[model samples]
Target: MGNEKETPEERRERMRQRELSNPSSSGHGSNLSDLVGGLGWKGTGLLILLIITGFVVYSLATGN
Candidate 1:
């Protein structure tokens, strides 16, 4: 989308071809690391914190 050399149609086609080539994965990579990696190292920490928070919340809520 940022390429100045390509027209809108070209961009659309390029995107279409990219999607066609990797139909199983979305732009976020369809994986936890890929999704968090886009946000850099902080995202990893945030994800871990979220997981821990969820576990703690669950444990507290269920007396587990």
Candidate 2:
């Protein structure tokens, strides 16, 4: 009994209290990891494209 896990409702309430205490970090936009988690394969491709574009731009700018 002492080592029992918290119920879902209790966990949610705890999260709500935490968010109420620290508003910024708990907001929807602040949940960057969760937001990015749903990007899946498309997000990965976009990230790769951006990285490649940045590298190309940097190389051209530096004449390297």
Candidate 3:
């Protein structure tokens, strides 16, 4: 029944409350947003892209 439309700020507050209320949340430190500056899964993809591009550029520059 708590499916009412919540603004982004409200949604974040609700989630923050839930995490604070749950003791087990402590073990999982630094959720995805905090770890990636709020980039979440997109950050993972971007990081992979950067690594691959770097390797390609390095090989081409060194003629290897």
Q: Which residue window of length 10 is worst by lDDT in model 2?
A: 26-35
Q: Residue pairs in steric clash, candidate 2?
A: none
Clashing residue pairs found in predicted model 3:
none
C-alpha lDDT of all candidate models, in order: 0.83, 0.79, 0.83
- Give the best candidate by TM-score: 1
| Tens digit of per-residue lDDT, candidate 1, span 1-64 | 4598889999999988998798775746367655876878887788889999999999999998
User: Can you list the residue pairs that collide in candidate 1?
Assistant: none
For model 3, what is the C-alpha lDDT against the true structure? Answer: 0.83
Candidate 3 regions exceeding 4 Å error are 1-39
The sequence of per-residue lDDT tens digits that candidate 2 reaches over residues 1-64 is: 4226888888789888998888787545556566468778799689779989999999999999
Q: CA RMSD for every model?
A: 9.6, 5.4, 7.4
Worst 10 residues of 3 by lDDT: 31-40
Q: Please report the TM-score between candidate 3 and the true structure.
A: 0.40
Ranked candidates, highest TM-score first = 1, 2, 3
